[model samples]
Target: MELAVFLLRLLVGILAFPVYLLHFLGFWSNICKKLFPPSMVVFSAIYNHQTSSKKREHFTNLQKFAGPSGKLSLLELGCGTGANFKFYPPGCRVTCVDPNPNFEKFLIKSVAESRHLQFERFVVAPGEDMHQVADGSVDVVVTTTVLCSVKDQEQVIKEVRRVLRPGGAFCFWEHVIAKPSTWTYFWQQVFHPLWFLLFGGCNLTRESWKTIEQAGFSQLQLQHVQTSPILGLVRPHIIGYAVK
Candidate 1:
């Protein structure tokens, strides 16, 4: 049994060596920044197809924030490939923020395709520190599948609240940790390290909902739901909006 286990470990290590080497050499970051946008585009199409009804239900909440001109000023943190642009109401002004500068080119392409949305700017900043965006300036803040990868969820939520006007909304849909007793949670724990290393710092086991809940939003409405089964450990999701 010991020898068999040793051989299994050896085989796993050998298979994983190339990935580790890329990370060690800092090439993985650049590679992921370039490759992730296109991959997310494909994934977004499939994901949206599967969860269209749920997304529509959640996004409808945005309509409440439209100003007298019927347009809302929106900011999205970690806006990879602008996947959420299609969901915004027509004529909404959108500011995209992401830590990866490489995403700007693909984001611009997405902006061009989304004629309904007015492109404000793409700020190259992480969610934790979006100092470029003025405080209390945006009517709405959106983040989807973003908090799980951020270095500090609390700081990100703080920034979200800071950048929103009084009574403005903070909208989010994020995959989160499953219940402790579940097999999915076990797998999430097992896969977390490799997933973080390979997938732009995403944490499969992050309880992002907890961070949002404790952020002191004036009013919060959130729901826990399961998304596409193909998401595996990340199928558990929380979707909601909070008023600041």
Candidate 2:
């Protein structure tokens, strides 16, 4: 049993590396967009609609944190499919960066038809190494459901700080550690080995928000929604803003 388990783990790790490489090169992202474009559209629509109570409350919080949009320079790290582009205020110069070239293509397709949006660039690399983005160039940085998969969470936060101007806003929505159910943790721990193998290197137990705070972001405003505990195991659905 022990050797079998070890071999299984080895296989998972080996398979995960290729998934990560493909995702980094934008292959999986493009396939995902084509596979479920409607789901993507609906998800974006839910976030953009302030009338929904949850979205309204989140938007209100965002408004207090982000203030105005005129001349706002926005950066989204791990912007899969760039679905959130339409949610951000119009007129702000948006930049979406992801390691997946496939995701960049989907982003281009998603926004190609929209004339009102203005984006300065679409980057196909991880944000942790932003040699392409200039220092102190961004006004707002957003990360939605991206941190769980980032290989070097600490480095990414530091890069974000370096790129944002002083007093700039950083917004995030992510999953985190949960309690009241050891079962959730167990399943996550069990499935994680296979999950990462199949779906890029997305680990189930990445405490990214805590890492964000440690990376020098301050003036923090946060909101936590306790969902069905099982879903919280992998999708805690957290939202917050921090100032740089």
Candidate 3:
């Protein structure tokens, strides 16, 4: 009886290994969200070098919007885990809006570390509804890899325009819909359904450039880029700034 029980326990351990592994992965993924949102960390590192030039150009353009006070009132939509705190220019008074309250703690700590930035507020609202922000107030509206996942890209763009002061610029770096019939686009569609479930509602096939142009911005400048740093399915990006 003792020998039989030992064999059964060994078999049970073998059978449970995969389940335990999965639980361990899931737990770490959640922990990573608190430490640094996975989407921000993984994708930022992948596109960092490829996006360098465009980020500089767009940030330079946005610097013109700074007021006489020498500060830019920056409103960042989908600001996740304050991953962007390092990229912002000094004297960037930031107002962050995101649906996930889980990011609040990470954001607060980031704000404290960023002496160049002052935290205006953190609104627990999705980009689609930002009634709290007054019209024509902010000097810059920035979004990076954001619209691809927003529930209503159109409404969010409208909100961006409504909140920006006249002449304020909207800076964006986002992956867009790849050319049709390509191997990359094909796989994007194949994985579209599960893409959001795995990686925070990000879609690979959003026509992000067209959506921004139609958002009633007074001036739109975009550069559609093909970068090999990431998988082909997510390597096509549009990076530029639009003026309101």
Worst 10 residues of 2 by lDDT: 59-68
Over 114-225, each residue of candidate 1 has an lDDT whose tens digit, in order, gives: 9998999999999889999999989999999998999999999999999999989999999999988687876676666667876888999888888988999999999999
- Candidate 3: tens digits of C-alpha lDDT, residues 90-133: 77799999987787876787888899888899998989999999
The residue ranges of model 1 lying beyond 4 angstroms of the native Cα positions read 1-14
**Tens digits of lDDT, candidate 2, 130-244:** 8899998888888876788788888888888898888887888776655435655555654576665454566776766678667767688777655443344564556888898
Candidate 2 at 50: error in angstroms?
14
Ranking by TM-score: 1, 3, 2
In angstroms, the error of model 3 at 121 is 1.5
**Poorest stretch of ten by lDDT in candidate 1:** 1-10
Off by over 4 Å in 3: 1-54
What overall lDDT goes with each candidate model? Answer: 0.86, 0.68, 0.78
User: How does model 3 score by TM-score?
Assistant: 0.79
* Candidate achieving the largest lDDT: 1
TM-score of each: 0.91, 0.74, 0.79
Cα-lDDT of candidate 3? 0.78
Task: List runs of model 2 lying over 4 Å from the truth.
Answer: 1-69, 227-233
